[model samples]
Target chain A: MNESAPNPGDRIPPDELIDALFDGELSPRARREVLGAVRHDARAGADLERTARVLAALRAPPEAPDLTDRILHSADHRRRFVPGRLRRMTKLARAGVVVLALVVMLGVAAGRRAWPEATTLADEQTPLADVNEAFRDDAAAGVGAIRSSVHQVRMSFQAISTADPCVARLEIEAAPPHARMLTAGFVTNPFGIEDERADAPASIRCGAPRIGAGPTIWVGSNPLDPARPAAPDDTP
Target chain B: MLRSEEHKLIREAARGDQEAAASIIRHHQQSLYAYMLRMSGRPDVAEDIVQEAFVRVLTNLDRFDFRYRFSTWLFTIARRLYLNAIAKHRPAYDTDMVGSWKSSAASPEAPVEADEQQEARRDTLQAALLTLPPDQREVVILFHQHDWPIALIARHLDMPEGTVKSHLHRGRKRLRTHIEVAPSSGDALAESLA
Candidate 1:
């Protein structure tokens, strides 16, 4: 027996060769050779029988109880309503988040109103030129009342004059019933006014009139001529 | 089931057609149950895995990949569920119990001796299978029982084809030995009793 020559029995492992033969992996010639070898070898033949028996037994289908109704019932319940319910829950969660955000924003806005520092900062940021123009417009419209509530107007006046030499005077007195207020104010020339009057409380007077109170009056001098008294017809 | 027909049923099932889902379940339930039964060695666990696997598959039918066989997907889901179940509760390989369960439902027309022999062979085969490691058992069951080709088993088991052959070879050899030894041992016990 030459060591270099392939012995038919030693060419493959018995188990592998048997599996390959059964799996049809071997060519017809190799299969005939393996089959012949198994027929002659008792152990190989028994291995083949064992493999066949196991395969036969395993291949025999066990009786599987019908599970269609049970599975369908579970799937139906999940498909019909669980996903819809989850979607609804997701929508409700989104709505809740939106409502919560709105509440937070409203709360912050209300909190900003309650904080004097925030109110002052906001008022300081307002252009004095815009405020003067707004006052002039309100005065011209024969409505002394500023568009904003009275408290905001007071803070606006205090913030404006305290930060700049643009002196504005606003006065309010009782008006007819049902009207909130009658406001009269004037912007004075910064160049004509003496520097000392810039600090004078009388030059930038603002009345603390309650909102929605009885109608109040506002009177002011001509902005172009600080010395001229406000005409009686200017009072609304 | 034909692949085209299976795909059609899957499409309809994905759209929540209960009839289509039932068709799919009926086609697959038996083979899947048998696979689970062999893997877990418990009919109850097998039944639970089958029902749960079908429910999960039908519910997630949209996610199924069409390139693979539906049976592959179903078996994969069932295999995972079985692994999880076994992790929670280890299954027992009770030959007497399994034999009785199978034999009780044996074909009424078959002769009693033939049925007994068939039941004994099945019992011995199952007991021998349980003795092998999980990987070898799975490879053997997929190859021999389900008639899956070695390449498909490789893909399913996520291993090289050579490795699958190695497992199959080893598993078959062990099964042969256990099955061969079982009857002789029984014979020796009977001789002693006589």
Candidate 2:
């Protein structure tokens, strides 16, 4: 025996060394020393036996209850436990659908605002033929004929007279593309000849006598001023 | 189960395959249940922890890390749940009732005397384990019971391997003393007879 090796009778093995021996963690030399110490020491032998018994009992498999059905059933009842990827995908799909609906709705609203339906004053008011006939008859019958025969034309002039001048001007300016047809008819200067000039101030003339043979009325051109009877010289 | 096979099942389960989820549960539930049963020493608590752990794992299957073993992740989740359960209600273990369920399911092939002896030993072991500190008890159970390596237990418990080994050594020594002092059922029977 080497003098460097501690004699087993010198002292009992430490609990750590004994545990390491049982755990198979000790080197072969350490194992031999521990076993030699344990053999020489009855207390160490009993301690080893107790540890072996405890470890054996612990290693023995415990009866595991079969809980497969219960766990699966409980999991199902608690929630539709979809996996993360599928759940995220489902959420994305729902959000995509909502976004698509909003986009379509906004697109339709913008399209309606950008391109509206066509509406003309002729469509809403009296037919152009009737107005021309009334104008022609009134011109032939002179100033007295304007009150009786030109009923529609008188009503149109009265409407323009009572209405906001700016609103009436906007209506004329906003007329549909086909409004140029009105100027080509017998009622040649229905609103007044000077009113046709872009630079001319807005005005209305009601029952004013014509400059020559026709019963044309050339009212004054200042819209802000009150409507007055036209002087024959004002016909230009 | 093989690692490759387990990964395949995990993928299927994440895709919402009920059968795959069931297979995963069937493969792991018993060992997990045994672990919790030993840890809590209450059948009902064990059952509850096992069910809750599976529910949590299956619900968040996509978050699982593939590099680690599925069992490691599962046991980690179960350990957390057990700790939470303990914090909420520190159960007083009924040693007599600890393994009573096993008695009914005991194998017919085993001799009656040996089975009773085995049951007695298991009860004594569980009672002794309950006497240890939580960390020591966990190290002991994971090491001796589950046959986990010291390195794995160290990783699982988030401690150093040396600390884990220290706990295991101390836990085993304490368990031995507790078992030696506690009166076995056989001894009680002998005393009654005498």
Candidate 3:
């Protein structure tokens, strides 16, 4: 305690000092000093008393209804979407991928016909029609014995008459037995690579159609092609 | 200083332990509810905010830094939720209310209600508290109602000690002014203050 600390006999302390004392900010010596002053001075005593009264009344509210159950329930519900538990969804997605891949293999093995020798088309609007026409004609040739075990379908193209760099769009369509046609498209820089293969598992997994209709692919100019006039390359 | 066991409970609660979550709620619910009741001036609203705060606290436990008190983090989240609720729906602080819905902690004598005078005084103080700006009201509520130390309050509000002290001082000044002039056609003054 400070020797100079005021006694209870002293007058009321300043308001800031009283506030600090109430707030528990005063040091021990200062607190003792303020307490001593507040004890004897009637006004200071009332002020301190009033402040304490207010603080106590704040606690008078009855206990709130227990919320632990509700909170826990909400949390448990939300945990499903939390990233940490996303592995559950990942497991489901993986199962779906496996099923889709199986469907693709079955479809490719059961319905694939010996397609007419591969057709190469130049990047032109008219050749795009020719490409589609060629795919239809080949599918019309009818199905044959499926020999290959490997399920990869490779589409190779070498652009011959393009002035600027160009890309080719290849759409692989499979008509599964009773379901709608499933189609997947790929864009290729024909100048850079001779061919691009769309894996059976991935291209087939794009849609879950039945597994009976054979797969036919139509190769054309980049659908986003600006101007096209050259005839398609017809090499086998 | 909190017990080591309480910290353990926090860690366990963060790991999805239901018992730990219950313990944490039981430990802080009273103080938390009272604080919200004082801040929001409604028992229903206070309860809802507390429930919402607990959900947020439990869900975000991984992000909670152990450097600070758990109660501080809990209250910080509760405060933000209440503010957001207020922003969406400004609640009415009405008159002649009973139960736990008072903005300012009333003078203790209000409970006993020895006479009509004491009751009126309590009402006036509540009205005065409503007149305070939210910043000042929050400081006052945290300091007086919750017995929070100035330093802890500074940390909770992310403000300097001087600022917290300033808000407390101004808040107390306003309360004093309201209580002193509550009688004799002071409704206008109270409205202007609000």
Q: Provide all candidates' interface root-mean-square deviations.
A: 6.0, 5.1, 7.3
Residue A9 CA displacement from its true place in model 2, Å: 6.1
In order, what are the TM-scores of chain A for the candidates?
Answer: 0.30, 0.31, 0.30
What would the per-residue lDDT of candidate 2 be over residues B1-194, giving only the tens digit for each residue? 89999999999777776778889998998788878877887777788899899988988889999999898999999999999877776644434445553543468998888777666656666677788888999999888878888899999999999999899888988877775676564243223223
Q: Which of 1 and 3 is the better model by TM-score?
A: 1
Number of the candidate with higher DockQ, 1 or 2: 1
Task: Pick the winner on TM-score between candidates 1 and 2.
Answer: 1
Instruction: Name the lDDT value of residue B34 in candidate 1.
Output: 87
Docking class of 1: acceptable
Score chain B of each candidate by TM-score.
0.85, 0.84, 0.76
* Residue pairs in clash, model 3: A120-A233, A121-A232, A121-A233, A122-A232, A122-A233
lDDT preference between candidates 1 and 2, better one: 2
lDDT of each: 0.68, 0.69, 0.61
Clashing pairs in model 2? A210-A216
DockQ (Cα-based) for each candidate: 0.37, 0.35, 0.18
lDDT of 2 by residue, A1-236 (tens): 11223457778876667767666677778777777877887877867766776676666666777777777677777546576677679879999999999999998778777765532123554578889989988777786644443454443345456753333433443443234233223133444544334433333432223356453434444232334445544443
Q: Rank by lDDT, descending?
A: 2, 1, 3
In model 2, the Cα lDDT at residue A163 comes to: 56
Across A25-45, the per-residue lDDT of candidate 1 in tens digits comes to 877777767766676667667
Q: Give lDDT: candidate 1, residue B127.
A: 77
